[model samples]
Structures are given as structure tokens and as C-alpha cells.
Target: MATCEPLYWRRCRSPIGWFEVGEPALIGPDAILYAMKKVQLIRDKLKTSQSRKKSYADVRRRELDFLVDDWVFLKVSPVKGVMRFGNKGNINPRYLGLYKILKRFGKVAYELELPVELAAVRPVFHISLLKKCVGDPASIVPLESVVVKDSQSYKDVPVEIQLV
Candidate 1:
């Protein structure tokens, strides 16, 4: 003998329109519970699939290694006054001479010798803010290739300054 099942309905209203659920409900309470379980199973499967699709091979952490007497390009924020009038600020991406990397503090912070003019301000910077100057390229071909010979020689040379 077949038994009659209780029907369930869900109603939702939004600014744009109204949505109704459980239209033409024909399943028993046990069947409805089973369908809900199936829906949850599908959701869990989708989450696992999406997580598996993520690749971390190309994702790299930024690394900046600065040593004493190494040349580095400092990224300075534009001064307010210079930015206000649309002037290219003084610290605009210029390759300054290799300043001696005085000391390294913590993992990402460092203290360096800055030009006398900039000495009035703080000279410490995070490693992320500094880029090692690998020297200018002599020429450009189909592919961007570094002048290895020049870079190797530059790396070998050390910065020397006499202290008064």
C-alpha cells in the first residue's frame, strides 16, 4: 500500500522579484531529506575540485638580498609638493651609485647610507622597496637578454669610500 507524503515549500522575496521553491512537490519527507543530502554532497565535491585546480608552482615570494657595498635602486614616493604641481619628483627612478648597505635588521628591513641631501630623512627601507641594479644592457635582441659579462664584472667589483 502506498502512503501519502507531506509537501514542503520555500518562498523568498527580493527587490527585483519573488522566488518560490517546492512547486509541484511530489516526494515524501524521507525523499526530500535524501535530495538535500545529495545537494550537499555535490557542493562538497565542487569545493574539492576547485581547490585541486589551484596551482602554486608559478607563485613566487619576492626576495631582495642586499649586502654591504651593493648598488640598489630605491623606490621613493613622490613628495607632496612635487606631485601637486605635476613635477617629476627628485627621487624619480634614478640609478644612484652603489651605497654601502650598512646593516640588515629583521628579515625585511635594512639601513643604508644615503646621499647627504637625503640623509636628513630616514634611510631605512624594507627589502621589497629596493631593487638590485644589475647594470644597463648594451643592446636588445628578439628576447630580453642581460649583458652577463658586464653584470658579472660589476658584481665582482666592490664599493670603496674613505671615511674622514
Candidate 2:
């Protein structure tokens, strides 16, 4: 008759390391047992925190009401040399238009209709990329103006607006 001893022993490397089997006689089993105990403690702590709960219905919040065909101002950093040059590097002007809101995604994303020229460079923008331009108190135009005409003359207006 032949007797057989265990081929492997349970072992662990560190407090957060995985438990594995190792050569039975090479290392002490105490270190592996200690690591397993620490791992169990961490798991218990995580379970307790997940089970705890509190009511959040009393928290004050504001509801945003945005609809299709509403005018808005988008904050854009102009491309250097392409839009403006030198000394005017820091100017990121707001573009105003009556954007037709197509769809809403979650709380911070929206799909809007933009002009073909602007769409060539930037087709979509996040809500954080836009700011609502109300109006200038001293200006003749109460709201921000958007040029929607298809004539070639409209291209010149952007250059004029940038100068002032």
C-alpha cells in the first residue's frame, strides 16, 4: 500500500493579492491565511455600505424646459488663421441662431439644426458647448441675429462682425 500527501497548499502574496495553490512544503501557510482574512473583511465592508440607504426626494432641483425652434448662442473657439489671426487669438465669440432642437439625450446633450457652412466644420455640439444669448441692452436688435440667406453677400457679414 502507498500513502499520498497533499500535492499543493493554499497561499496568498499580499493583502489584496489572489489566493492560489502552491508547493506544500516550500512556504508557511500562516501568511496565506492572514491574507484571506483581510480580503473577507473588505468584502463585508462593501456589502454594508451598499445596503445602507436614505431618501433623496426632498432635494431641491430646477427643471429645464427647452423646445424646438428656439434661439440659442453657442460658445465656440475659432480656428486660428482660418477664422481670425494674430492679437485676436483669445477671441471666442458666441454664434447665435434659431436652432431647431431635434432630440434630447439624457440631461446634458441635445441635437440641433445648424447651417450648412457651420456644419462643414462642426456638425454637433454638446449643451455645455452652448450658452443662451439673451440680448444687448443698448443695441438696436433685441435678440442675437443669425443670417439664414443663401446669397454670397452673407459671407461678408461675418468678417464685418469680427472686425467690430
Candidate 3:
């Protein structure tokens, strides 16, 4: 005499091994429910593994590309080059207003549609210093307007202030 261990679906990696399904009289509601839960557990595990792979792929992948005429916000660096923060880090802006991409200079550098006031600064900026912006233009808070001077020290000017 020999015993047989039934195999489930070919793709399933579940620990559960087989039972006879033809004996409907012996199959109770609890058994069906248990089978369903097991399948669902496997589904969840597969989904998690897929999600992990996607995230890992994203980690090594490049960021979003910017095309000409696309709108994006410029990232601000509080300290760089001979620029001085002068212990005024509290009021430094994390990012600047929206700028349109003018040209894809090289692989990562881009020319932006900068304001006339920022004429001194180079129009071309690296991709790392830019971020995509998707928001209403009217809602942006102009906390401190950047006053760039002579390609050296820049200033952040606030329009209003109140002690709280």
C-alpha cells in the first residue's frame, strides 16, 4: 500500500499539501474558507515581493526626465561656493518658484526660463537642483524673494513679519 501527497496549482508556493476535493460530503464550509484564506495569503505575499522588486528597481533607476516647456521648481542651496548664510538658516528657502525648461543642454543639465533679475546666474542648471512642481500658481507663498547679487551672496527678503 502507498499514500499519495496531492500537488496544488503549478505556480503556488504554499506549504499546504493536498486533500481529496471529490468528496463534497466530507468538505465543510470551514475547509473551503481555509483554502480561500491560504490562496489570499499567497496573493498578498506575491504582491509584497513584487512591490519590493519595483522599489529596488526605482532605487537604482534615474529620476524623472524634464522636457522643454515643462514646468518645474528649482531647489535652493542655502550654502554653496563663497555664498554666506551668516547664521540666517532659519529663513532660508528650501525651493524657489516655478521655472520653465528652455533647453536640455546635455544629459543632466537644463536651461531654465529664469527671471530677468537673475541674469547673473547661469541659465543652465543640473537636474539634481530641480524638482517637478504640480500645484496652483496662485497658492504659492512668496515668503522671501531671493535677491541674488553679483554671482556671490544672495538674500531672502520677506514681505511681512509678526511676532507670535
Candidate 4:
């Protein structure tokens, strides 16, 4: 009966013969050297492909650095069938608030001084989850002023009713 062996072993010139009893000396050091050369070639090819992939990724990568006390907007992801920050819909804002950076955790993590309404969320977030907030800082509104319910919803109270 013929036995099945891997194609790589066959390429490596390793003895895989049926019916013939081959001695150890039959497979000389040359065959072993050939196998080692094949392995080295595979490793070199793998390294070349990996470097190519990394170069492609580096092209799209952006360096983000934020100082302490800098204001940044937190990127919000709206999950299906989940309500966040009082709303979840097509019109929901993609980014939320001017959160102040409390501290930097390494190069890619930061601790933000989040509002009271966001106490449920972890203050420390990845740099990718944040965007630098530009323009006037006074535009930020205090979360305490907004009456957000436990269900992340708020009632729209009419401050004035003007009859037209």
C-alpha cells in the first residue's frame, strides 16, 4: 500500500518511497541542506509580504496627539437595537460633546472628564474613539442642565409657546 505524505516534504526531497527500504546514508546532507534552503526561502517570502501589507496600512494611519486639558469629541457608535445617550436613530449625532482630557494613558489611550450623564461609560477611551474639538469652547453645554432619564431619554419642555 502506498502511503500519503505532504507535498512540502516531497519538495524538500525527504525520502517517501514505497516498497523500497532506503538507508539513512541514502538521504545525504545535500537533501537536508536543500530542505533548509526551501524553509529560508518561505520565510523570506513571508517577510516581504508582511512588509508590503504594513506599508499599505501605514498610508492610512494618522498620528493623533492630545495634550491634557484639551477638548475632544467622543465618537459614538449607534448599535442596532440599543439606545445610547438618550437617542438611537438615523438622525442621531455621530460624535458627542466637548469632553476635557484629564490625563493621557500611553500613546493611544486617554482619560476624559466626561459629564455626569455619561457616568455609566468608562472615562478612559482609545485615541481612535476621540476627535479633536475645534472652535469656541464656550459652545459646550453642561450635562447637569439637561434632564436625561435613566432610560437615556429626555422630555422636551416648551420654554415658550408663541401662537402664530
Best by lDDT: 4
Ranking by TM-score: 4, 3, 2, 1
Per-residue alpha-carbon lDDT of candidate 2 for residues 55-163, written as tens digits (9 for 90 to 100): 2332433344555555566556566556431234555455654456677677777677776756555545677665554553233343336554666444334222333
lDDT of each: 0.56, 0.52, 0.70, 0.76
Q: Which residue ranges in model 4 land beyond 4 Å of their true spot?
A: 1-26, 81-83, 86-88, 140-164
Tens-digit lDDT string for candidate 4 (1-164): 11112323433333333123454445556776775676577667777987999999999889999999999999988786654765745577788888899999989999999888888888999999999988657755567889988999998755543465
What's each prediction's clash count? 0, 0, 0, 1
Encode model 3's per-residue lDDT on 1-164: one tens digit a residue. Answer: 11111234343332343444454446566877897786667667777987999999888667779888888888777766633322365676677678889899778999999998677778899898888888555556664555557889966545454455
Residue 24 lDDT in model 4? 42
What TM-score, computed on C-alpha atoms, does each candidate reach?
A: 0.38, 0.39, 0.43, 0.64
TM-score of model number 2 = 0.39
TM-score, model 1 to reference: 0.38
> What would the per-residue lDDT of candidate 1 be over residues 6-118, giving only the tens digit for each residue?
11133323212222454554556677677667556656776686566654432555556778666676665555543222135543543333455788898888888887766
Off by over 4 Å in 2: 1-65, 77-90, 94-98, 133-164
lDDT of 2: 0.52
Q: Model 1, which residues run further than 4 Å from truth? A: 1-60, 79-97, 135-164
How large is the C-alpha RMSD of every model relative to the true structure?
Answer: 14.4, 13.6, 14.2, 10.3
Which number leads on TM-score? 4
